[model samples]
Target chain A: MSADQEQRTIRCLVAKVGLDGHDRGAHVISRAFRDAGFEVIYSGLHRAPEEIVQATVQEDVDVLGISILSGAHDTLVPEIIDGLEEYDAFEDTLILVGGIIPDDDEAELKELGVSEVFGPGASMEQMVEYVRENVPEKE
Target chain B: MSDLIDELLAGKHRALARVITKIEDRRSGHRDLVSQLHQHTGNADVIGVTGSPGSGKSTLVDKMAATYRDRGLTVGVIAIDPSSPFTGGAVLGDRIRMGSNIGDMDVFFRSMSARGSLGGLSTATTDAVKALDAFGKDKIIIETVGAGQNEIDIVKTADTVMVLVPPGSGDDVQMLKAGILEIGDIFVVNKADLDGANRTVQELREMLDYSDGAILQSSGHHGAGSMEGTDGLQIEAESEGWDPEIIETIAQRGEGVDEVLDTLDSHATYLDDSGERERQARTRYAEEIRTLVREDVNDLMAEELDHRGGMDAYLDDVVTRETDPYTVADELVGPLADCVRDRRKE
Candidate 1:
């Protein structure tokens, strides 16, 4: 994986997983990522676990960012991570989560293979940098 | 729209209900479905109804819902009950009084607990509304568990907000929370069947007078003949044991729902037809976006800062009075606020 390969168009798919419909941030992030030159595909409100995994595979995304505000993150995120692992996309895709996460759950999410867990108030600058620096590029 | 959404868009009842349920379910892969729905939204009107617990909002909401249903319109209802602190979700579906229209297959009612959300709505209520909006419900009604004035959060997402006030709830102090008055698109003197309905109406009228004469009154219960119009139309007639024509109803009995519906239509029409309505709607949309953005950004920062022990540092600073929350906000994203506002205007 190299920068030349990285420029193979950093494709990112932003999805609001589970019952959360508060997509203002998701929409904002999509535009920001688009502005930063990634091919962005946004999955809007009320998405299920399987739909997200299928979209991640179908889109062939380098990173999958899921936003959950429904307060069911503890149960929901694991389902997606486990599902992705089961589907074999878990290793290839960088999973990031944002929104109303309780303070106690960060280590658990990270242990579950989530690349980054962002809470509210993080700058778009930080987000773009984190994703760009971490996600692997094709050979 | 996708095939499933196409079916929902064409007014398939089962599809509509199922998709909304998916939108509200925490484990469902609701993202793609929502993405599909986003393309099909903007067809429905969202009306938010909220008030105090004893204000008879659900009943009034029920009546209002029925009125819309009878006119051959599809209705989507989201009922928010108080969440017990222990469980962090709605423990009771006590809003069963509004069942008159809930029985209709065309009417979809989903109940939720507030789940410690300070603003009176559960975390998922807005998402549920979006689900209803995407499902092509002609009208969406949100019945909140009346957290007094603070319940105004519903106004953040709704096009029109109806505030319910029951009779004999005490003076003006008891009728509304201090700052909550501004959130109401219209005011109702609900439970017109109770004593002192006139006094309550009078108090509301007095409050409205201060605002250049802008509030309307109605009974808050659902079913037949529940809310009759007062003779003055501008003020209560004061000779009321539930004015049969003006406001009459046993919500459980389903009386006077037709008139309440008529009042809602008239108010909505008034709002939509006015220049202020257009301006207000646009402002509301912007606010909705801002609230979501603010919360999302806040949560992200809170988590990151916590991980870095920044919050602990901030707490230490605050204890020593070195930095307040305002100072912290200014220090962190203060410089970026202007840019966000500018972008929002765009």
Candidate 2:
């Protein structure tokens, strides 16, 4: 990598929102991002939407991966987006949701500012490539 | 001053975060930014908390920050996790354990990756502390990447370095006898609710007693705590007279946190009374200057090597024994040495 490219390394945050105690998937994706040469920050399980958004802003991550398994994506994801909007971070941040996201709810989530949704069995490589290509350039 | 520094000094959390990111990434102008921040520092109490993984360093730091907030003292926390050496990437999960400061901008928690630094702290950690100090934080806590014996770098960054030992780890206590034991200002026996808590504390006390004289002498380098130089005979007494303190706590329950806070305050006072703070600052500034000069010279040498057609150009000659590695090094460094020598003669 060029010096400039190395300095501008992509930073990603893997977050678990709400009362989802299952974190094996979150851990898996966090490791995947790390192996992809992205600095990954994992917000452990049972985080509130506001808490996750707060961390996102503080970390200034290029990608925010919200891993939800509790089927509360409809309520929790929007609140997180709203929190990011409050800080004007929603636009600059590429938001990705993973884990048990239904096809019916995927469209609504993308409409609500989520960049993409990866259901079960979505290849980690595909998600990694998607983030590498889609992360927004910093000013 | 740049707008970012201006905003940071004006107490904007976003600016502080951006400043730290710039420092961590080593972006252009970060050196200049840190130079500007130097004048605004020395007000905050910098503390370092480090221990082995699962020793509850984060839990204790969270409680410490929350307690400081309750006392109306603004706080900043920098938690570090190691990066993957192979990939140059890291998964920093320290924020997960630091839930108390969430949504409270006053705490200003940031997670940093070690980024291939062998010392268990990112190279930018000192500069990040400067950013927080310039932002007017009252207490700045640095939580190091938890690699037990290699955390001596924490001494350079913090006034008080607390090493936490999980209860029932008799082996862990012995491990401290290597290097971590030398730099610790306060030894915390965390998870005091565990079965072997008392035994752990006893072991720590015994160990501290055994190392009493050695601690006073060797601690002069980094100013671990009190250990006032014994009269004029001992040159090592740059700090106040402080024997390391041992405290036990169940960090998960906030047990014994008040004592930790009190010990921190007492250490700070001791630093002031003994005039060790100024001495420590002088030593740190000297080290920082040396480090910057060394890094800059290294970069210059790399550029010079490239100008001389790089190392590959000399490879064939060295392989055939027509020229040796030392000769090549001397040839590369010769011009710089000549320049210095000529300047001295002039």
Candidate 3:
């Protein structure tokens, strides 16, 4: 979040990572995030490790939301977090992953430092509020 | 050389890149730039590449462009990356795969975001192609915007539309959505090095066997399987590269691109001899754009009527059974017309 948004609220970056090209869910959720008043930067489909990180840095976003349905979550998710950490966005940006997961990968994904994994039919309003409540209120 | 046009016409790579940015941003001066460049079009052969996600579209387009450049043809590529439906911005990552061609003087490749367009293209894509067209490229290849079947809109703009089916996908049969199938002039089964390459070809042949259109199947990965899908829709057995006319190769290796190019030229000639090419292009936007404009105007009227608690009140009245939606809409249209008339009176 920039100082302007942080003065009152939070800013978020939502991206589609890896080859998971299903974007309708990501797009709708990002719009929900935006309507919730969080400044949202959505990186369109097929983002590489470096590209997502560059967007996170440039946007100064407070939260990172990733939507992947390509079954490449295990490979792409960790690499993106690592890139965020390298870019110093890890501590500042809260990471969220949403997509069609088999339910078995949820625990491992969270253990690898993802904050939340909302699955299919997840509530967009709840996700918006979840981000709002989680990001610390700045002085 | 209206800055970008001058650069594009001069065959400058960066200028083409920057103009794509301007057009994507919907900047003010773009209309004039494209208007001037319009005269430069009709020279390049437009090829569209589209397929399922992770189908290696960017890599294939990169290799194809390089191959065209090698053939002493100036290449123009419009790589359509998907855009964030929420924020309306694109990742434009084809540059990662197309490393050298980014700045090649002879090859101009521009990566564009689909910009919330459901149809695998931006509103500016046709104009962008026109810009590249006017730049005098002999061949222009458009990579699909990673949106799968919806990206079929490329058929309206491209001279030869290549429907890429990656090997082992098992999803190739699903790509025959009404819009996409009719548009494909040639079919490329990319990633041929994979195990299910032959099976995929067989499945596609079987599916297209009874269909009316022409179909060709070639691998874009390793140079293998040149069998044309139109030959036998149902291949009982996979024979040697018997026809040699169909098997093309190695999008990753840029192998057999010459063959792909030759096929595209032949197909274009066929379309010309049959006279289906211009007939299609003329009515391309007429039917589609007519409905699109009506939709926009309907949406405009809706927004205009919703400004002052009008929608909420109408809904409340309808919910209360005091008024049907048709009556409310009728009541609203009169005021809406008056509002428009009053504005005109101003």
Chain A TM-score values, per prediction: 0.91, 0.95, 0.88
Better of 1 and 2 by DockQ: 2
Candidate 2 lDDT (Cα, 0 to 1): 0.81
Rank the candidate models, highest TM-score first: 2, 3, 1
Inter-residue clash pairs, candidate 3 = A1-A62, B1-B6, B40-B134, B205-B233, B209-B233, B220-B251, B226-B246, B226-B247
In model 2, the runs with Cα more than 4 Å from the true position are A1-6, A102-105, B117-122, B146-150, B171-177, B214-240, B344-346
lDDT of 1 by residue, B3-78 (tens): 6577777765445544544443432355467667666666677878776777777777777677777788988777
The digit string of per-residue lDDT tens for model 3 on B1-346 reads: 3765776677654456545545544555665776787677777778888777777777787787777777778887776656566655344455557643533546665555554533314346777788778767788888874354446665456777787777776565464543455656666677777778777766665455435433543534323355433332223124321121233355787655666777777666666766767776667657446645555566666766777565787788789999998987777667767887999988
**Top model by lDDT, which number?**
2
Stretches > 4 Å off in candidate 3: A1-139, B1-15, B28-40, B86-90, B100-102, B117-122, B145-149, B171-180, B213-248, B287-292, B295-303, B306-313, B322-346
Which 10-residue span in candidate 2 chain A carries the lowest summed lDDT?
A1-10
Provide DockQ values for all models, in the order shown.
Answer: 0.02, 0.47, 0.03
The alpha-carbon lDDT assigned to residue A54 of candidate 1 equals 53
Better of 2 and 3 by DockQ: 2
The lDDT values for all models are: 0.63, 0.81, 0.64
Q: After superposition, how far is residue B159 of candidate 3 from its true place, in Å?
A: 2.0
Candidate 3 or 1, higher lDDT: 3
Query: If both were scored by lDDT, which would come out higher, candidate 1 or candidate 2?
Result: 2
**Native-to-model Cα distance after best TM-score fit, residue A19 in candidate 3, in Å:** 27
**Which RMSD does model 1 reach against the true structure?**
16.1
